[model samples]
Target: MKRSKKVFITLMLMICTLSTFLVGCKKNDSKATTKKDFNYYTAEKLKEAIEKKEDIIILDIQVKEEYDKHHIKGAMPTYAFPVKTDEEKKKIDDVLGKLEGKKPIIIVCPRGGGGAENTYKHLLEKNIEKDRLFILEKGQTGWPYEDLLEK
Candidate 1:
């Protein structure tokens, strides 16, 4: 009788543990939304969006030198100034301020090689909703438009 009781308890515990893990897995699978969790779009789609004047911001996160060489017209250069101190943050704010209330701000870099993924997380940490931010999947170089302004 004692051995039987122990087996039953162990089985119950195993079932409970499995149930908890399943529940957690389910929660993870369900996609959650926030400004940081935004999806990256290709440049082709982005151009389409631009033509339609969609509510989005096309941001270039590359070095100014690269930007000066060539970039999509009207795209904002976000990392123009290095953010070394809190004062510099204000500069960032100034740029971000212009983009305030804008949905789906698309972050772009040279071939999508910049620290855009981290920046996206930082923006989310700042309470920017996930839906408000996006990344250009292929980036400026990958943009399929001949309008690429080259240096």
Candidate 2:
């Protein structure tokens, strides 16, 4: 009976030690694996950012026609559709060239969702650092128009 009790105690100790080691390892692994992604800002915050004259590029991904009607005061238009050819890529590069690579990019779409999301993903795939990307929470739908400009 004493031998059986010793064996059981040894097993329990081993399990406890293994579990604690795994938990500690998991915490470190998570810290290392954590990744930065595109950030979301509310309309008010975007206004504040603009007012502060923060170094940012507001990339409007709405269709050209809609963008022409009205858009955030200093937004540059860039269609959200994927670039298919070298010419299309050059056009995108031209727009991107207007700002320095380190400038934060704020993406806005007509009503958010697909356009903004897809554009965000495309930019990521293009190797634009995630820390430099942001999205307007609700796009033009949430914008107050106080800082809007019409072309």
Q: For candidate 1, lDDT tens digit of each residue in 1-151?
A: 9999999999999999999999888778855434345577877788888778887777776777888877787788765333444654444565766677857888787766435665565567667777777778877778778754545
- Top of the candidates by TM-score: 2
The TM-scores of all predictions, comma-separated, are: 0.63, 0.64
* Segments in model 2 whose C-alpha atoms lie over 4 Å from true places: 1-37, 81-94
Query: Candidate 1, residue 34: CA error in Å?
Result: 16
Report model 1's TM-score to 2 decimal places.
Answer: 0.63
Off by over 4 Å in 1: 1-38, 80-91, 148-151
For model 1, what is the error of residue 95's alpha carbon versus the real structure, in angstroms, after optimal superposition? 1.7
Error of 2 at 26 (Å): 26
lDDT of 1 at 5: 100
The whole-model lDDT of each prediction reads 0.70, 0.74
